[model samples]
Target: MEPRLTNPAGLLPDVGQAVNILYKSAHTAGVPGSVLELVHLRASQINGCGPCVDHGARAMRKAGETDDRLFAVAVWRETPYFTEPERAALALAEYATRLADRPDAVPDAIWDEAAKHFSEKELAAIVLWIATTNFFNRLNVTTRQQAPANY
Candidate 1:
């Protein structure tokens, strides 16, 4: 689909810069880059944001994630590719991203599991990553943004 307009980040440089700052901070929030990309891809899949799924998967590959493991991110519970910590982060990402679908938003069980694997700072980063991805997902989906062919 043709996008309604150019990417807002390009159209509005100041707002784009602010988002870039948040994006950069999330990357340094101590979560592994691979785990963060997995979280990003899953959330984009849930949100049906094609651009994000494309970009996130490419980013994961660039970080040396195997295709087998990246492809299995959606079915993480049934896969043996992820470590406990990665699984915990994915669980948290799904729960947080689907907040409107469930009464609890993030159930205590999921939070407890993630807490087991991540320090408070890391947890904050994970949450921020999820939130940031969701923000971009909405923007892209709403604007009918398409993934670049090379992305």
Candidate 2:
């Protein structure tokens, strides 16, 4: 899609501040950068947000995530590449992103499974991570931000 408005400077600063807070909180809450990236990629995939899918995947790779696991993330249920914690996180991300489909919030069973790998604080971070990515996805999609093929 063609670029609509090139001057985002006026609006982005405030949004950037919120993003900064989210990042700091996520790190402080004990969510690993890698796990955050995985959740980002998964949520982006579900939303079909190209920029996030591309950026998240690349960030994960740069952080030393395996290509095999990255490629299998969409089909994670069938793949043995992800650890149990990662799998649980991915499942949680999916539910969070597709919340309208469930409307009841994430189930306690899924929460319990994810909690096996995360402390309460970490779980809070995961929720924020998902929420932030969803916001990012909507923004990028609304702007029609395209992901570079190799990004």
Model 1 alpha-carbon miss at residue 58, Å: 1.0
Which ranges in model 2 have alpha carbons more than 4 Å from their true place? 6-10, 149-151
Candidate lDDT values, in order: 0.90, 0.86
Per-residue C-alpha lDDT of model 1 across residues 1-151, encoded as one tens digit per residue: 7999987767886977888888888888888888788899999999999999988888888888999998898899998999999999999999999999888899999999999999998899899999999999998999899998772
Q: What's the TM-score of each model vs. the native?
A: 0.95, 0.91
How much is 89 displaced in model 2, in angstroms? 0.6
Query: Native-vs-model 1 lDDT?
Result: 0.90
Tens digit of per-residue lDDT, candidate 2, span 18-130: 78898789878877788888998999999998878988888888889899989988999998898899999999999999998975768888888999999999999998999
Worst 10 residues of 2 by lDDT: 3-12
The numbered model that scores best in TM-score is 1
lDDT for predicted candidate 2 compared with the true structure: 0.86
Determine which window of 10 residues in candidate 1 has minimal summed lDDT.
Answer: 7-16
